[model samples]
Target: MAEFDVVVLGGGPAGVHAALAAASAGLNVALFDENASAGGQVYRAPLEGMRAASNADQQAGDVLRRELTASTVTTFFAHSVWAVTGDYRIDATGPNGPVHCTARALIVASGTTERVVPFEGWTTPGVIGLAAATILLKSQGVLPGRSTLVAGCGPLLAAVAAKTLEGGGKVEAIADLAGTADWARTLPAMLARPGLLRQGVDWWRTINRARTPRYGRHTIIRVEPADERLRATLAPCDAAGRPISGQRTTVLADCIAVGHGLTPATEITRLLRAKHRYSRAAGGWIAVADQDGRTSRPLLYVAGDGAGIAGAAAAATHGALAGLACALDLGAANPVRLTRGIGPARSAHRHAARFGHAMANLIALRPGHVESITPETIVCRCEDVTRAEIEAACDAGARDINQLKAWTRCGMGPCQGRTCGDVAGELLMRRMGTASRETVGSFSARTPLRPVTVEALTGNFTYDEIPIPKAAPL
Candidate 1:
């Protein structure tokens, strides 16, 4: 296997920054990203022959990509890391073929995935996640539909609405689960970072200019097919997100884009056996890491949304700190030189983290929302497992998420619970009367963390090279 001083997983803001920092310190760094490009989801680059609507972010990503290319770091784009062993060996499938590499130090910056809670008619053809819609617009320069209803619990709802308008898609309405009071409560924290506040204002201005109907403290109660369109029932929700009895509104649109913020992408970290803690504000279970991104596992670190959902700025800062720390540990750079950059990065991360916390509070998912799930609503779209099925399993004494999985096969699918784990855990927790989500626990990470083709796995090796060990003496 090829070896490196450091290997960084992911190509998002954090991964790129970490690779750059470590390489600049004269460490042989190898960075592997699943995407064809370096920018993570937040700063995803537009596809070839397409231009992104947000020039600033695109330009910023471009600058980082340029710097990464110029650095000594070896980049492997379009590479999916499937398994990472305890010995720091990584097995991945790249554009060419299988890649096996080992590193003395490892950094995981795998980023975040959308947190989707299912509702009635969510499986309908027109429904999509907010992140999916954003990717469609930003990367491919395509709208989800001609007319769309955007509903969610976070700032992404507003941002997607703005992007939809900018991309020439008609936004029927924008519904936010957080009320005006929620925004007011987060004012002080929001003010701590003027740039983030300005970005929010900018999205607001776009929606305002388009005169889109805006609903606060509202959520989609149900949706039904209406000819070629979808009819979504909206209801005013209480602080806990339980729908109010008397208030209801209906929206007609070609499509619905919805999500409840993001959760840390923790499969890799979990597989590595890092300590984790549940933080609702930090976007579910996250790796326990210091400000410098050093995890409980020695010589292993996690940064970006994989550590917590602290947005792009904080992710970059955290990545820098992790890289510097790695450099210090590897003796590639002196303590004074490496330590100098960490203080400012740590401060920036603190400010960004505060903003992230405020935003998380404003858009927090409540237990009431979980209570609202109908028996028929599909909880695990990958496996077609319904709420009723999960409840039945729980009633049958499936105490933990793993038990639920074995009983109902809820999380056994291609997505591997990336889309349904949180909601499923919530359901199991409520049924089992579990005091905390941590008690329910997350799905166990297994080999081939992501889907891989059989051909890719076996085509690279001959039968003799399969490494079948001889039987031990009885």
Candidate 2:
């Protein structure tokens, strides 16, 4: 068991900044990350030697790595927090056994979970997520497929298509859900961060150079596996983002990479019972917090994409501000040490968030996309609950996710509803229009955030040998 002045949950840009700031303020800080190294998805550390790919991300990640290494913060890599008990006690599984930590303040920068809309053949082998494709290209030094058809909303469509081209993979087509008009609307705000905008423009140029057909306001209707290849059917979407039934085109590719932006990974926020509200543009129900990421829960802050759908730059500043907030609120440091730090970080965040918000709006989930789900489409892959079954539950008066789980067993699988919860809730929300989204709340999260075997849970005493946690000080 260990205790600290602050404990940060995640090693992404936000969490790293938070821990560094808090420790810099003369506070004992502990940071935990699920990956073997620090850096979450956006600034994820590339394989040593390979360096995987390039961009501002590479430079930013390097600087972050150097600073974190120089900081006094105690770092725990490959540590997954399974639960938060009491005010700010962390229960996690580390290298050997259970890691117990109590802190005066806790910063949750768990980041975002990639949101993928369900389709007829989403479960097919060759179909991957736009986010996952980047992981393959950036960290694994491998391509998604020989010929990948990239489909989705937001800037990732162009970025992934371009990266695939860079990795020597053929890009058959780029299917974007946002039309030209929609992108035009975001231009003003996206221009707030000219560097990122320039990066995006470069990606588009690369895509065009490869002669990849780009379809605007288009979405993947479905993908059918044909021998060793995939036949992806796409159609132009209406104003609401629903596919126009009759205008379908098929693109042949060995793989399909599709995604619908990202949602705040709210398992920790929900477990801690922070206030939540629905903001479609911010990627569904998010934990409500101040600019410094202070939540309803006392001394608990949420930063980065976990608070909302802000990009990596905004997340970093937001996290540092949260750390400074902890120092101020918890009396962990002198006011003089933090006064200068807070204002500059806040201004930087506001500037970066302008571009981030524009991107969020671009990838916002549209009602028509969720409504377009066919009756046969599986809503919960873990439990195989079809859209029809979920709708039937809604028709039978199941409003909240808990009620749906009770009646239809939609969230009863091993996942306990992480992947399917938001999409399932969106289905339920449509049934109760004008009603508060909070009324149709998400699935209640319990301990052990991720699935664990019984042996791991019970210290493996009953089945095999394993280490056990030493009793804490009485």
Candidate 3:
């Protein structure tokens, strides 16, 4: 029964800004996030041994952390949001037990998930997504291997390469489809905004200084294992699908970091019955919201990567606007000034949309990416389901994500379906000719979002109301 003026779910950039903006307006606020600490994927924490190796410019979360702590918002770390009820009732697991809390307005800042591409030998020991490698470096300060090949398209590959070099790991080369010509075309878009352009220039300088070979117009045709390590064969393909042997090369590395791009985290928003649309520029299906981050549901709002795969900066801008809009909806302050926050937020969204569109198109993977999937490759690591089982289920008419999960148990594991749900859904969609819009389903959520000990749930420590004390300066 804990209550507050606003409850922002997620501790990343969007949630951080949304909470601060609302608290600055003198409204009681509570921010809940699953991670023990703040900082989402982009501003991941430096692991024990990797602190000194992290990229400085990309670490914007460091600056925002201080601001959130000083604000009037109370933070609930390691808290999972199980479900959102009418009028923003949130059920969470605390040290005590399963507790239900309420908020006058709710803002969702849940972020993005990696778009995992399945291929031969992907389930090997050292293979991981580009983002997962970065996470390991940020969270545990460990690299998957001494030498790694970064294959996939997007700015994240470059970012990961920069991190690998910083962490004393060797990046053999970056293989991407976007060649010099395509990158040159995107240059004007980058240069149009000085701030963005500078960020790009600084990143390019790091790539140049590292002396890591970058292969534009290159793709990984196949990956093989040798002596328990990975050997990737990459080649430049012509328009007619012929390999350019002169440009073809083989790389022997300890690991391969690969991913197409990121998809929006839209499960929570969908749970709230928000309208969504397929936005090619935004990566995939995203919640349809207004200029101020107002979703179809009046009491609900979404910002950051949850709304779409816009980066952290855009997430922050949308967060500010959503916070202001939520306050106005709840009758907290002057609506006029709050409405003004939309102008800059809208402009930033446009800029982000353009960049996201270009990147999505450039790195778009072929539908046959999953063709190499075999019966032995694990599809759901938590549940131990195999790719063959999923294919069998699809052949049996389990075309939708829900049906596939029920029939093959692909997403029934302890992690629910958060990590592997979309991948399964996409695979089914590709095979059965089912469209993505209808395949999206609500995540199978249970009560007490966070896992609490049995002793705590039975105790008298359930927090029914959020304790909002005297206001603090934001």
Task: Choose 1 or 3, whichever is better by TM-score.
Answer: 1
Q: What is the TM-score of each candidate against the true structure?
A: 0.95, 0.95, 0.84
Q: Estimate the lDDT of model 2.
A: 0.87
| Overall lDDT per candidate, in order of appearance | 0.88, 0.87, 0.74
Clashing pairs in 1: none
What C-alpha lDDT does candidate 1 achieve relative to the native structure? Answer: 0.88
Identify the runs in model 2 with alpha carbons over 4 angstroms from their true place. 433-435, 457-474
Better of 2 and 3 by TM-score: 2
Ranking by TM-score: 1, 2, 3
On the 0 to 100 scale, the lDDT of residue 382 in model 3 is: 76
- Model 1, range 443-472, lDDT digits (tens) per residue? 998888989998876666678787888899
As a whole number from 0 to 100, the lDDT of residue 268 in candidate 2 is 88
Indicate the residue-level lDDT of 223 in model 3.
81
Kindly list the per-residue Cα lDDT of model 2 for residues 1-474, writing each as its tens digit: 789999999999999999998998899999998887788998888777775455788788888988999999999888778778766888778677777889988899999878888989998889998889988887787889999999989988887898899989999998899999999998898778789889999998898888889899898878898888999889889868898857688999998999988988888888889888888889887898998999998998998989899899999999999999998988865788698878899999999889899999888878899888889999898889999998888888887889999998887887778678878988888876745567788888887787765555456354346557899999
Model 3 local distance difference test score? 0.74
Q: Residue 326, candidate 2: how far off, in angstroms?
A: 0.5
